[model samples]
Target: MLSQLTYLSFLAVFAGIPLSILVMGSVISRRGDHQPVRVQVGGVALMITLALGYTIPWDSYLIARGVWWYGEGVVTTRLWWMPLGEYLFIVAQTVLVSVWTFQYASVADPTVGHSWRDRLLGVVAGVAVGAVGVGLLLGPAETFYLGAILAWAGPVFALQWGVGLRYLLAIRRRIVVLVGVPVVYLSSIDRIAIAQGLWTISPTYSTGLTVGGLPIEEGLFFLVTSLFIVQALVLLRWVIARWG
Candidate 1:
């Protein structure tokens, strides 16, 4: 019955359940820090809005191109080219990472000051990754999915780096914990969903590569998206600290 769960129900179980628990825990833990909580909550709201706005169009385009598709009876409704469940996923994932990031932000002392060298390094690295993605886009067809993920995510990574590479580096360990846990956990669930026939990735668009039966592209997809959410929340907190 678990594998038989509809796509929406699957998210309700995996994403919704954990989100409710984490949100309650975050609120209880931060109850004493009212101002910071307000700021973080505001930041999370903004990130959620931005995540939905940014992801919907891109995901719809991918679906239209047959990069991926949902299984029969797994989805009950469609919005444009995406299943409604996919939209919920965008919101759920952003909030999940935002709440998790707050756990670190509440206790960690802010890293002050910035360096042009660090900023430049971050920009160069982001651009380099984007370049690689562009190259893959022009190469064999199988690399297209990976290429699209990198290309879509690279510029945002650069922008975040440009704003707070120094700060991000200072809190590197926290970043790892914030981004890593979600990516691995979500990737595992994603593997399960694929196994259950909830959705199928087009072999024509994806690299025919697997990590423990999960596609490498799927892992990278979660990796970059998690990084985007975590980095945004951390930087937003940093900005509020400096200017708010």
Candidate 2:
């Protein structure tokens, strides 16, 4: 039974993830009348930039290592199904989260010129969401990476972008900001993971680490990929409540 299941799992990993993302992404893209070409472009750009940026050095490092022994086939991370499953995961994850949070962008009331009360609400909201989301979906390893994306990214983005608006207001203008941070941080985690084989989308993805009866990849994955979907869901909920 176990062997049969493993075979099926492997088959799904090889066949499933990438295909679904393409379909889902397109469907979601067309849902909004006001959607911009740039959002789609940005997604492409992010995937390319991140994939190239990460894969280049990762391949290089793997090559540099005595033997990468890499090959292409269905690899099961068990979190999702597909070859380069993480890519599809990232893309689908990105779109959903961006769109979801983008929903919150409706709250700003552009005529207001940004309100501190709202900002405080956003911070409180984001933090509350982060904490609660973290609590519901999180565990120890995940607590670190996902937490970083959710809690810290908002403030970090505010500083970098000079976003003087409150959190809710910021969402109103665009929840893309909310989406971007988690995406970037998650992408970073993936890049690092692939390079180190902390977790993998392909059969050959691996690193020489294991702990507490789990692959290092899983531990790292626990920290990274799990919350991506949740963050997207939460942001989307917030956005819909505000906008819809």
Candidate 3:
């Protein structure tokens, strides 16, 4: 119960990131300053908003459509004025937004300062992780599961770009982003995958496993995939900084 509260708190902070950033951007833009911090925070907010923008509305639609039944046979029709689930869901929505915000922070390592090679490596790492996620983790692709996989996993990638850019910090970081991003991303997504049990063999390539409705490897896959994205974005920044 306490753990759930903590989780919800994280959600609230993450969900509010965009709003916070927007306010910050407005203030900073007024100052006529283009500080990287402000720009970065703004980018973070925009990315997060763009990323999770779809889920909240869709969830609302589902709730309204009577798609989500309930837990313990209790339908929370209202919590002080708003529907109970809706209220909880608003919190959930914020959390969903927040998770992606912190998750995608810029690579913190000094080594990831700015370099083309490292950034490119991050891209390679992200792609590799994404591929692995589509291949080994999910255990084969069934006609490109983007729409399905993306619904849950997209947020992670939104934030992983920093970590992915952090790829150049070391071979260890590279490997982690390459391998770990997908794992984390996939796991985050797999639980909500709402698929048929663990070992969700995507209709081919054999060998699969599942736990609580998603593949075991998926969580780890998400982690790696998100990191790679961070890495690639870092690289892009390096290029633009050099050329521009």
Candidate 4:
């Protein structure tokens, strides 16, 4: 069962392969609009690095503290409290989201511009999330799952808004659709995985809330992750255009 769970984990990550191929291939087909695939590829690499760098420690802490764990006999290998599939999940999700955002952004053809409105919105958003995150951290220990998630993701969300808020604001609609569609789609997949006993979350450590059998924290995880990848792409596009 453990090996089977490990295989299921592998299957989840492997799903990204065909997803990436399809989205990236579409971008290539419309190269006239999505020219400079290098930018998209470069951005994907960068986000993957950043996502893994951040998520590994965050996830490691959770696993170490028993906030979540794979079902019995479900993990075949471990690297410092994390299953190998987790690392792959970070990369796979980063690539999947980045490529999807890039492909769609190309189609949207948004005019990127920085403005005071953008900065203002960024600061406001950052402060809001940071405040919530801090509040959660200072709250009950049983809320560790929520607190940890917000504590980590809130700052990143705020930072992206502060740095690339305008670019994101410029492409807000696309980002919404890009992030929204996948959040819902992937949330369902996640619910199924949980139901199948691929992994288990501690109800005591969570709000015990379920959306389609997935803990709300788990849904927020995907939501924040998608947002991070999309915003990272926006920031990368700006950097490449400015410095590349």
Candidate 5:
């Protein structure tokens, strides 16, 4: 059974520790950085706001629809249909990714031009993914979780890609590191949470697929959300550079 303490402990261990270390490192290494602390903080704050606004309603719907649920005593309170802890998770995850993004943000020079070909290719790919998700959503109950994730995230993916796909690709290695580390770490923790009955992904709504005991849908959820944060931050930096 999941207690509120267990949930908070997970956040403390997985998110809190890394965030503390990163902040300390930034404070110590603040010399000669392209972005000032104020700018970095402002960018992160903006991303966090966007993340919460975009995610809360979708997550609430997921809980209400029985796509997932928490263990007994796992959450002590609710905001709309989500636990308070869940909201904190959203903020923590956003900050983690956004901070990591700034750490590696110096690698890419965003002034270089991008071709229309790349933009079209990315948009088409996003549309295709969304189409597949829509099909799954209409097919059967088992794919609802996966479908909802893709359907919700695909358009955002397309928009980001259309705006700055080439720029992102130029900084692909940095983006990979920033996005991959947290996604892998958080997904691992999420796997443990599910295994320990901290929360349950509804079998009826999810495809019966697992990656080393973690649901595939859960993995995809983390992956896309992390990507969203990284993409937005990287592009925002680019915009500021080009026109700020």
Candidate 6:
């Protein structure tokens, strides 16, 4: 029998690819919608690249510190102590999210706007989050998992908002509807994976807090990750339209 991680690895790809295809189908099927093919492709590519760049190092550190651990033999391969499934996860999740967000944008709120003040606050908030994440890393916090999640996630989220808040906020409703559906679905899947021992979180590095068997940090991880992708998609639409 395949280990749970192996099972999950297959599931992750299966889920991610079809869902992305579904989103693309939705995008192309919509009447009167103009798809920005080049920009969408480029933006999603960047999102995947950046997502891996961040998650790989962060996850490796967390695993090394016992913040969480993947079950032994769950993966058939490992890269620097992180599972191959994880690397695929970065790509799969981003594709699913990027396609869905842009699809929703085409259907519901198709215009992008700008706001200088939101931009300013976004930069300031990103800086603050970075500062706080560093402090948490250096602080005497009994568990660093929360800090670590927030440190990276917070700044990335804030910076994306800073540059793209106007566009994001314009379609905030679509964002909420689109992003919420997946977060709930994925978080539930994640909860099951954790429960099944696909991965383990160390209580020593966590607050022992959980929601419906999912840790608060895990929940935030999904939320921020979705938001980051959404913002990036919106910003790409805005920039590509403006300058492309």
How would the candidate models be sorted by TM-score, starting from the highest?
Answer: 1, 5, 4, 6, 3, 2
Q: Write the per-residue lDDT of candidate 4 for residues 1-244, one digit (tens) a residue.
A: 3235553454555455568676769756874364476766777888888888888998998899888888776677789989877787777777777767776664433356667778778878877886787788778876778878777887787778877786776677777898997688668767866877888898778988877678999999899888888777767666566555
Worst 10 residues of 4 by lDDT: 1-10
lDDT of 1 by residue, 156-184 (tens): 88888988888888888888988999998
Give the root-mean-square deviation of each candidate in angstroms. 1.8, 11.2, 10.1, 2.9, 2.1, 3.0
lDDT of 6 by residue, 1-244 (tens): 2344463465655566678677768757873257557766787788888888878888887877778777766777777877778777777788888777766665323356557988897778777877777777777554477778778876786778787766776777777887797788778878877877878878877778899989887887888788788777766666766666
Off by over 4 Å in 1: 31-35, 106-111
Which 10-residue span in candidate 1 carries the lowest summed lDDT? Answer: 102-111
The Cα local distance difference test for each model comes to 0.85, 0.40, 0.41, 0.75, 0.85, 0.74
Which of 1 and 4 is the better model by lDDT?
Answer: 1
Weakest 10 consecutive residues, lDDT, candidate 6?
1-10
TM-score of 2: 0.34
| Clash totals in order | 0, 9, 46, 2, 0, 0
| Runs in model 5 lying further than 4 Å from the true structure | 1-4
Better model by TM-score, 1 or 6? 1
Q: How far is 228's C-alpha from truth in model 3 (Å)?
A: 7.3
How does candidate 1 score on lDDT? 0.85
For residue 212, model 5's alpha carbon misses the true position, in angstroms, by 1.9
List TM-scores for all candidates, in order: 0.93, 0.34, 0.37, 0.86, 0.92, 0.85
Candidate 1 lDDT at 33 equals: 66
Q: Give the TM-score of candidate 1.
A: 0.93
lDDT value, residue 94 of candidate 4: 78
Question: Candidate 1, residue 30: CA error in Å?
Answer: 3.8
Candidates 3 and 5 compared: the better one by TM-score is: 5
Off by over 4 Å in 4: 1-14, 17-28, 31-33, 107-112, 239-244
